[model samples]
Target: MIEADDNENVERLRRIEAVTDAALSRLDTEDLLDELLDRVRDLMRVDTAAIMLLDPHSQHLVATAAKGLEEEIRRNLRIPVGSGFAGRVARTGQPVVIENVGENDVVSPVLRDTGIRSLLGVPMLAGPDLVGVLHVGTLQPRHFTPDDVQLLQLVADRAGLASQARLTMIDRTAALALQRSLLPTRLPEVPGVDLAARYVPGHEAGIGGDWYDVFTLPSGWLGMVVGDVSGHGLQAAVVMGRLRSALRAYALECDNPADALTRLDRKIQHFETGNLATVLYAMISPDREWIRVSLAGHLPPVTASPGCPAELMSLPVDPPLGIGAVQVRHSTVVAFPPDAVLVGYTDGLVERRGELIDIGLDRLRAATQPDDAETVCAVIMTALAPERPADDIALVGIRRQTPAG
Candidate 1:
């Protein structure tokens, strides 16, 4: 004969373990969330159940999954951490229950509109990181007990991992597709100029901000670009894409490399606020005798000429995009002697853990010599790139044809 309280406790225990069910873990990353949210609503007997995940860039919790509160997800509900009910749960990293809800208690209007009266929320943790907040709401007033809070937390802990994995997987797939489609498949042929490039994603950070671009202007000037946005995952990749496109458009309009970068900086500061990135733009003359370059907080490119040792180019520096002003941008011209080779790359090529980045840069300089573009790319990649890097790397090489060419 089981007592009523014993039966209730047993039910709670059963629901808690259900979160770790083997079959539940095997479900598809995306479907996992919807299924979990449904089970949560049923288990808690709540009118609404929703999951809000952190948006690292904006420092807000964005509604990702919901049951009964479907409109919230559609509206892309965002709650700043430390502001309201869910925000308080995320900030305190604890369970919160409100027997009676009010307009003053939450930042999202969806809750008030839904007429939700009682709410119980818990922090969704993936190891030590506060990945999100999971909360249940009821239209009728209810006093949530300790046992109820614990049960919701159990569900939230598992939901955190599933939601994080699903979002990361989706973002990574989209980023890879964008990179493959954006990067040039075959280097263009320019009568006396040879070009080659290489790109590799980091093992730890995965697909990130590193990118390279090459194109010929209608004015017969050759444009080369290399840039690295500061951050990782899909957000960084998307920002990189926008900057790349914007720079290309600006390149068409601004004849000078400095003017192009100045415009790029202004665009980033105006539209993509709070993001930072380094970029280098180089424009070679039609005759291949001179190259004008603008660098914004980027490492200098290495140049090697026939019968001469490779060395880093000297250029005036400005703050990275999103930080620099139009007046701060400047361009410098360098002699592009016949048969000279120039290689531009992201910091990932030369930066290493615990070791001075100068060492890697010096190694790259020593490895390169006046050679064909393909040879220069091969040598630099072979000499510097690791089997599994800590950050993404992008490299591009250019060589002017000699008399023999």
Candidate 2:
């Protein structure tokens, strides 16, 4: 037999779980948060209920959703961790109860201004991490019981899991969409050049910043790029897009790959400080007889010709972009005869954990026989990539076609 309080807690738990049930999973994150807050206020019989999510980067709690006290959200209230009642709960990862809330008990005066006389707050935890803070308040003086604290903690737990999942999903979906938009939909049709590229995102946190591009310059030269930014998720993807655009714009003004990369390095070092990346930029001659290339801490491309084995091209490698040191960039010319194939790629294609990278490189070298661009791209991906890769892979294959074959 359950006590009256225990019965009420069970009822409250049931109601709270209803909002986050699978049937309601279709609601957008914001809508779900709003609905959760509504249920919290009604179930707890509080005058105001609100949620403050932690911005780990800032180490501050930001007002995300509110009920009965809309000013908290409207004003974008922020509370430093450990500074006040809500902050204390977040910092300690424990429930905080203020029997009679005072002006100084909170960082923001909005609680006092709204005449919230009592507050019951709990830390929203996703595993050991404090994802945010959840609290409810009332204008009337009331003693919040342990039962109340337990029930609210349960609410925080549910909300914490949902919020983390929804936010991660949003970031992953946005990053993938942005990357696809930046990559070429169809390789440009150059009379003497055959091009095909492949990009596979890792199944990690969000998405990795791996990109490849091919375009024709005003001088009728072919511009080829394969680069990888150093981090995962949407932020890295955004940085990759900026670098791609800046390189293309610089390519228009500069005469050679080294000159364009030098300008790009200056821009990145000045503007995108702390962001590091490896970039390989090349321009095939209009006659398709040779390719001029520059590398920034990037792997050299592999070249293979008719009845010949593939080998990695050796060239002077410079420091990666945003190194913040004085450096020199150099371009090397490689002989590219008709029917020869060249492959440019990011490191992810030939790097496997617990295995020497030289072995992967040798395997890739063995697989790249003189073949059509599409076939080469497909073969390399199959030969080098794992069933579940740990990093993003970007590859581009270019072949100069021969009239006979």
C-alpha RMSD by candidate, in order: 3.6, 3.1
Cα error, residue 174 of model 2, in Å, equals 0.4
Candidate 1 stretches greater than 4 Å from native? 1-12, 37-93, 100-118, 127-132, 137-142, 326-328
Instruction: Give the best candidate by lDDT.
Output: 1
Can you give the lDDT of residue 76 in candidate 1?
Answer: 95
List pairs with backbone clashes in candidate 1: none
Candidate with maximal TM-score: 2
lDDT of 1 at 64: 89
Q: Which ten residues in a row have the lowest lDDT in candidate 2?
A: 16-25
